[model samples]
Target: MNLIAKLLPAIALTAGLSAAQAEGDALHGKQLYAVRCAICHSLDYNGVGPTHKNLIGRRAGSVQGYAYSPALKNSDVVWGEANLKQWLSEPEKFIPGQKMFIAIPDARDRADIVAYLLQAGAQQPSKTP
Candidate 1:
């Protein structure tokens, strides 16, 4: 095979990642979070679920105070982008017996939400009042 053929697959992979990243629009993510996640979660406080702030790099279910399921609390899951996306896609499948019951079937929505979490998580966290 020629050099161009060897490079084609790598180029395509790069483009695919770029496209996925680009799909996560900030405004759309914020809107979707309000509509979809705010019922049980918040950026600052622990509601039905734990706060989403500082979630990207933190271990899953390691947040203090909130009662996590035994399955999640015992497991070791660091919330990188890919795992976070997977958890958003299917909570039970990602971590069996976890309390969260929602699933974002659309990949775009997951991407947007993941983007929003990462962006927001990087900023100063809100006070948990």
Candidate 2:
């Protein structure tokens, strides 16, 4: 085989790894969600928990049709990066009796999720802008 043929496998492997790392490095939050969250929460629909589509910058307990735990419904906190980070780090600790499960252990992962959520939510609005 030619030199190009000898290098093809290495080239393909490098390209595949780059793409995998790109997807894995980002959406740290999404990975956390899929493992620790998606069982209950979703980006579009409330599973056992609330849908997270526009959770960022949105009012607490204001998803129209979704029923929120009283603790969450009465929560005065607005959904933003800082609050989300704290809340996800320790759901029950953030608000005793919160319906959410245990907080994510990794702070950076939680922040990534929050960033991803904000970005996801911005999709439609940015289109208009």
Best by lDDT: 1
Candidate 2 per-residue C-alpha lDDT over 1-129 given as tens digits, one digit per residue, 9 for 90 to 100: 799999999999999977755433346756666787778877778777878776767887777788788888888888886788788778888877778766767655766676666666543454453
Poorest stretch of ten by lDDT in candidate 1: 118-127
Q: What lDDT tens digits, residue by residue, belong to model 1 across residues 3-100?
A: 99999999999999788667687678889999999999998899999998788778878889999999999879988878988998999998999989
Q: lDDT at 117 for candidate 2?
A: 67
By TM-score, the best candidate is: 1
Instruction: List per-prediction Cα lDDT, in the order shown.
Output: 0.86, 0.73
Candidate 1 similarity to native, TM-score:
0.77
- Model 2's alpha-carbon lDDT is 0.73
Residue 73 deviation, candidate 1, in Å?
0.9
Residue 88 miss distance in model 2 (angstroms): 0.6
Q: Estimate each model's TM-score.
A: 0.77, 0.68
Instruction: Give the runs in model 2 whose Cα sits over 4 Å from its true position.
Output: 1-25, 126-129
